[model samples]
Target: MTRPKREPRRPKTVWLDDDQQRAWRQLLALVMELPAALESDLQRTTGLTTFEYLVLANLSEADDRTLRMSELAARANSSLSRLSHVVRRLSDNGLVIKSVCADDGRVSVVELTKAGMRRVATAAPLHVAKVRELVVEPLTKAELIGLGRAAEAITDRIADSG
Candidate 1:
């Protein structure tokens, strides 16, 4: 029996109106510039990349300063492979240790070392100051709340689509 042929799909185009175009442009500029500025500040002060800091910070916030490798990658917004590499580097530096989960041998877990805790503790104040200087200090309370809501909405949309 012959299979039926499927119809070709039409590509949909979204053309932004003037206000939307302006908003998109501003968001685009922010997406391009903000990370670089933050990364530069982090690298200059702590010799840690933004990703490294994120990994450390997320681990610090976790219960017992430990998380499964997969969970850490999601929290860090990193790929599993990338997280593995970063974890290896951190291990080499004595910042974190990775071991097989006691309950599940197939699962890998990462725990922040005492040294990692100390490193993050040292970096936190400087990072917070930089964040205030670059992002928070200039915004009014209402604007900050609006920004947070906007970010949450956008992230929700992205997460739903993906």
Candidate 2:
């Protein structure tokens, strides 16, 4: 028996209005520029890339200054493979130590060392100041709260889609 032919469905394309287009383009610009600016600031002040600083900072906040590699990857918004490479580099620099989890030999864990703690402590103030200068200082309290809510909503949508 022959099967009947079927029509392909096209996705709906809703074009943005002028105001929306302008707002969207501005958001895109901010996304691109903000990370670059923050990275530059971090690199200049601490000789660390933003990702490296994030890794260190996240670890510094954990209890006992330790986290499982997988957990760290999640917290850093990184893939396990990418986190492994960075953790290795950090281990070599004595900023952190990588070890087999004591409770689970099959699992890997990382601990921030005194050197890492010190580095993050030194970098935190500079990073915070740069963040305030670029992001917070220009916005009113209401605007900041609105921005936060908007971000959370977008993030929730992204999570749902993913």
lDDT of each: 0.95, 0.96
* Distance from true location, Cα of 60 in model 1, Å: 1.3
Would you list the clashing residue pairs of candidate 1? none
Writing each residue's lDDT as its tens digit, candidate 1 over 42-146 gives: 999998998999999999999999999999999988899999999999999999999999999999999999999999998889999999998899999999999
Per-residue error at 20 for model 1, in Å? 0.9
Q: What TM-score, computed on C-alpha atoms, does each candidate reach?
A: 0.91, 0.95
Clashes per model (N, Cα, C within 3 A): 0, 0
- lDDT per residue for candidate 2 within 1-162, as digits (tens), equals 998988899899999999999999999999999999999999999988899999999999999999999999999999999999999999999999999999999999999999999999999999999999999999999999999999999989999999
Show the colliding residue pairs in model 2.
none
User: Which one wins on lDDT?
Assistant: 2
Question: Per-residue lDDT for 35 in model 2?
Answer: 99
User: Could you give me the TM-score of model 1 versus the true structure?
Assistant: 0.91
Model 1: runs farther than 4 Å from truth? 1-14
- Ten contiguous residues minimizing lDDT sum, candidate 2: 2-11
